[model samples]
Target: MRWAILRELAKGQSLPVVEIAKRLRTAPSAISKHFSVLYHSHIVNNEHGRYRIAPGLLSADRQSLDFGCFLIRLDRLPK
Candidate 1:
């Protein structure tokens, strides 16, 4: 589910919880928990209730995200 969210955000767009839930076919409440973890971990940034991947974390090529522990290749995830 996190991967799915990341995949969507990989487009370099910040989105609100409701929009994310709609894209994932899940309820907003369901994703809020994930957002909390992500926000705390600094994996995503929250601004005015919108979330986006942290800056300078995505590779220059935009093929993957560097979590400082692992690399998540965007193309490998389900669309």
Candidate 2:
């Protein structure tokens, strides 16, 4: 679910919990929970209730997230 959320965020748009939940077909509360984890980990940024992948984390191709020690590929995410 976090991966899915990341995929949505990788599109380079800041989104609120409600929008993310609607896109993923899940509950907003559940999305908030995931966002909490990502937010604390510094993987996502939150501003006025909207969230997005933290700057400098996305690869140049926008196909993966470069986390220094690991990479999260987004190309295979289901539409």
Candidate 3:
């Protein structure tokens, strides 16, 4: 799931939730849930109704350490 989100974001374009949901063949609500997880994890950022991969999440250094460490400090978003 993380890889899917990362690959989609790596396209370097912000995408609407509906578009991403269609591409992934999932419900919008499901996409929203996954997106929220990624957002709170700092793997993605939401802005102005669109989403983009966060810079720090893709750092090579981040991959070297346990990915959970980076996400630990982020607060879980309300559904």
Q: Residue 75 CA error for candidate 1 (Å)?
A: 1.4
TM-score of each: 0.88, 0.91, 0.67
Report the Cα lDDT for residue 76, model 2: 78
> Per-residue CA lDDT of candidate 2, range 12-69, in tens?
8899999999999999999999999999999999999999999999998879998889
Q: Is candidate 1 or candidate 2 better by lDDT?
A: 2
The lowest-lDDT stretch of 10 consecutive residues in candidate 3 is 70-79
Candidate 2 local Cα displacement, residue 64, angstroms: 0.7
Best by lDDT: 2
Off by over 4 Å in 2: 77-79
lDDT of 2 at 23: 97
lDDT of model 1 at position 42: 90
Candidate 2 has what TM-score?
0.91
Which lDDT tens digits does candidate 1 get at residues 2-53? 9898888888889999999999999999999999998898989999999999
Ranking by TM-score: 2, 1, 3
Better of 2 and 3 by lDDT: 2
